[model samples]
Target: MSYRHTLTAFILAAVITPGAHAQSFDPGSMKTPDGQPDISGTFTFRTLTPFQRPQALADKVALDTEEAAQFEASERIRLNRDLFDPESG
Candidate 1:
């Protein structure tokens, strides 16, 4: 009932309450309002870059301008439909 105890309890509840009912979003299958899965995104050029840093670049934390250009070109090639196997599509 004291001011200190009430203030401490309120602060603790305020911090912990939101986490107690946390909602997680799985982006892998993000859905739409009508219940259909949503696949559309803002960007169209889906690059083929690895989510994790490549083993080849493990020792290099950041890329220089030249290296970045090379990486971008390689990704473009990877995402190019002409380079993909025709039989698969």
Candidate 2:
């Protein structure tokens, strides 16, 4: 009820209770009744290319195998340029 009583209770709780930091992963914990590793949910691999063709390339129908490879190479280089050498802000 009083401030001193409240402070005493808080101090006692702080001293008695141990803080939980983290728990390590245990593969054995994840299991299913069938025991097939319990694989679930969808996994997606993202790419820089969009689903639809850009307005700039609307006129172009399709690229040849070599041309497609070249396009992909150029795109990868352009996208990863900043990652290789980040400019100072």
Number of the top candidate by TM-score? 1
lDDT of 2 by residue, 1-89 (tens): 69999999999888666542235567876777767687677855367575778676688888889978877876676767776544531
User: Distance (Å) between predicted and true CA of 14, model 2?
Assistant: 55
Model 2 segments more than 4 A misplaced = 1-45, 84-89
Report the C-alpha lDDT of model 1 over 28-62, residue by residue, as the tens digit: 55778777888787864465667789787899978
CA lDDT for candidate 2 = 0.71
State which candidate has the highest lDDT.
1
Q: Local distance difference test, per candidate? A: 0.78, 0.71
Q: Where is model 1 more than 4 Å wrong at Cα?
A: 1-49, 81-89
**CA RMSD of all predictions:** 11.8, 15.2
Clashing pairs in 1: none
The TM-score, computed over Cα atoms with residue i paired to residue i, of candidate 1 is 0.38
- Lowest-sum lDDT 10-residue window in model 2: 16-25
